[model samples]
Target: MELILLCHAATRAMKTGHFPTGDEPPERDARAQLASLHALPDTRVIASPARVARETAAWIADTFEIVPAFDDIDYGRWRGHSIRETGEREPEHVAAWLADPDARSHGGESVAMLAARVAEGFASIDRLDAGRCIVVTHAIVVKVALAHALRLPLASIYGMNFAPLSSTVLERASPADTWTALNFAPYE
Candidate 1:
């Protein structure tokens, strides 16, 4: 199986460095960038249920399946709040959350929890008969999928970066076996 993980386009939350609250879709420039991608044929498209992801996926394909498991990490009490603001208000919580993948001091999903959710989402996609599957999701979801495919620990999510509309292709060597990332590129 082949997995084409595509990060959704930028939103107002992204620009403001706030925890995404599923408020806005891609900006004009991000729409243009998404339009520049080549057409994908004979592939199944799966998108996160977030508005930003759904809107971005519509630009890439006419039809797609919405998968809630691929939704942005629940920010809970921190939703719509900037990381800087959160840190300033709750320094200890921010520090613990950043330092530990299992921590959920923001009263939201932990990094490990998000990774597990993304893993479940990928597993369902893998069951499909399609040769290739395109997934439009949040940066965190993409990073979690990449870390899972690469067999990296959940903490490694902090080390990776996925720009808006970035693409990361993972090819399975054999059915249900090892997988390798063919290429990881930001939108040009």
Candidate 2:
């Protein structure tokens, strides 16, 4: 099975370094990047329910299944706020969240929770009959999927960068086999 995880296009909140509120639309240039995803015959497309992800998927394909498992990590009170602002207002909370994957001081989903949710998403994808699948989601979701596929620690997410409209490919021989990460690249 082959899986292609594609990050959604850039949004104003993304450019401004604010935690997403799950309602931001793609930036104007997003349409130009639509050419990045070429026509692939017999490919199944799945997307997070977030508006941005859904919109991105719509631009690439006529139809896509909305998957809650691929939803972005909930930011709760930090939503729509810059990371810097959140840190300044709640230094301890920020520090704890960064230091521990289970921390949820922001009253949102923790890193560990996201990892598990992403794992569930992968399992569901594996059950599909399609040989090639594409998932449209957020950068964080892409990072989590990569980390799961590569068997990297959750902390690795902090160091990875997934640009808007970037694609990360993963493949496995079967449902029982371990996944192998193929490549990470942004659509030009």
Clashes of each: 0, 0
lDDT tens per residue, model 1, 1-188? 77888998878788888888886767654656766554468688889999888888888788899998899988779998898999999999988887788999878899899988988987787678887788999988898888988899888888888888889989985666878989999766
Local distance difference test, each candidate:
0.84, 0.89
Model 1 lDDT at residue 90: 94
Q: Candidate 2, clashing residue pairs?
A: none
Cα lDDT for residue 80, model 1?
88
Deviation (Å) of 185 in candidate 1: 0.5
Worst 10 residues of 1 by lDDT: 30-39
Question: Which run of 10 residues does model 2 get worst, by summed lDDT?
Answer: 30-39
Q: Estimate TM-scores for all models.
A: 0.93, 0.94
CA displacement after TM-score superposition, residue 55 of candidate 2 (Å):
0.6
Model 1, runs deviating above 4 Å: 29-31, 35-39
Candidate 2 residue-wise lDDT, 1-188, digit = tens = 88899999889998898999998898764756767575476788999999899899988888889999999999878999998989999999999998788999999999899999999998899889988899999988998889898899999998899889999988999988999988898776
- Provide the lDDT at 55 for model 2: 91
Whole-model lDDT, candidate 1? Answer: 0.84
